[model samples]
Target: MTRRTRRTRPSPTALPGRTVPVAGSIAAQSPHHCRTSPFSSRLSYDSESMRCRKGRTPRTLILPLAPTGPMIRRMPPLLTIHFLPTTVESARLAGTVAVMIDVLRASTTVTHALAAGCDSIRPCRDVVEARQLAARPPACPDNLGPLLAGERGGTRIDGFDLGNSPSHFTTTAVGGRTIIFTTTNGTSALEHCRPADMVLVAAFCNIRAVADTLVQRNQPVHLVCAGTDGEITAEDCLCAGAIGLELQDHGGFDTHSHDATRIAISRYQQLAHDSDQLLAELRDSHGGRNLQKLGFDDDIAFACRHDTIDLVPAFDTHSSTIRTLS
Candidate 1:
């Protein structure tokens, strides 16, 4: 891709860091697909397995919707592509809809499992909580177990039935089951969005479905990038950028944006033409490299393919399960 915009360095606050929120809908469904460098492909993000990685700062940048420049026409679009700190306390999340992106696996797995006919998914913060939730598997008629899933350090947690890989969420394993998922990056992001009016999970595989819902709802859009290990990851930002672009193209969001939003849009513009190459190249990122070491290259590719499913999992704050929005 020919470079168009000059890449900007991360602000001191956004210095290389570790990390990883979303939901309601138009009741429509479709099927889907994360990260990379704003400029250098060498620093792009490809995997969602960096939660246990070490020594990274956490930061956030907001493109406030209030008009601050003449470049913006009329009122700003209700969308704000926020590059958020991987924490639950940020105040920017107040809104009607939050689209959570954790393309490496969490969001991807959640979407796939639900599509595979899982009853629902309850995202937990820790193994203990997930285990507790697992004990009472929603009283399904099938008597299937509530799946205890997640990972630490890219390996499945001891005693859990599954890891954070989308491949593990096959129909036979997850169908008719409720999944209590706890992941290093994606789950915490889900917790962060609990206060929002709606929380929707987004991954490459279901990007079109999520985007279609966003286009129908005239509410404010919060693009939440679930970063790697509480630090910023390129893949999440790329996903956010792609979501922002789709919203702009289909949802009538204004083009005016700032800081992190601009960077995300720019990065997406560069990689949108050839997502396969984008995914392959980004697998070089720390998260991607780590997952490959753990033998999840296939998982990465599977997660990268766009629009293969038609389910939009929306987190229900009251019920605590993310099911298809419809």
Candidate 2:
């Protein structure tokens, strides 16, 4: 993982076409944030020498990089996304870290489960498989029965311990339990990204944490949106766009697909303010409507929040479980 240190100096004019990263902690401003403060500029990650220079103070401090590291001179990986996956084979995402997004409920629910102190979450491929896992859970430190959770066509499945709603994943019910989870959208995306070098489950609930984790990893990534059914969902796209915005703030440019990142960022920037409008748009989205129809109004509100939960849930390749990283 890349480590970042901060330094401050008078802001200098950034070179043309150069976009610097917001160093250390994330910048507490909108994606379209404008700064008038002379000391507002932060440090940028330099891929060339190994030192933080103290010369001309620019809007962003350009820290020197290790003179010789795993330096690849290609365009940095683009903030890319596959709107939905009908099949499990994703070539473009073959070896890149894949973050599965299912904002409305699945991702949000699992994140809450972890934050609420669930030991771990084992994502099953299907309802039947989840039931089987729940029936015979693998050996663990705590031999408690795993909680069964899932949904089908936006409604709770029969006999499952919990539906794909964040509200139900509270501490009292899920704390200290192992969640054997299967969702209509998020789980399928996780399986499809099996070819990924790494898999992360993300949502608005923990989007900032996810972005920060990705920045630290300093590797290329592919975001797989668990679309509603087989079509694109606005909420997922918006979340993906938000990821792009955060990555951009971390010097993730010079390597990414403009076509993909552009639209997502544009979409998010257009609606970032005015919570009521964003909620209305989400309510009218296909996935949102389906969730609303099933009376998941509270869940919708829950998912819209950003940075509320500070956990980054990553799929453990060997154990096949989603574990939170401290």
Query: Would you estimate the TM-scores of all the predictions?
Result: 0.74, 0.76
lDDT of 2 by residue, 85-119 (tens): 65235766766788998898788888878766688
Candidate 2: where is the Cα deviation over 4 Å? 1-75, 86-89, 254-256
| Per-residue accuracy of model 1 over 170-269 as CA lDDT, tens digit each | 6667777878888988888887887777899998666756876775665777888887776677777777777777665553565455566777878877
Clash pairs, model 2 backbone: 12-58, 49-65, 50-65, 75-255, 76-254, 76-255, 77-255, 78-256
Which numbered prediction scores highest in lDDT against the true structure? Answer: 2
Clashes of 1: 36
The C-alpha lDDT values of all candidates are 0.66, 0.67
Clashes of 2: 8
- Ten-residue region with minimum lDDT total, candidate 2: 8-17
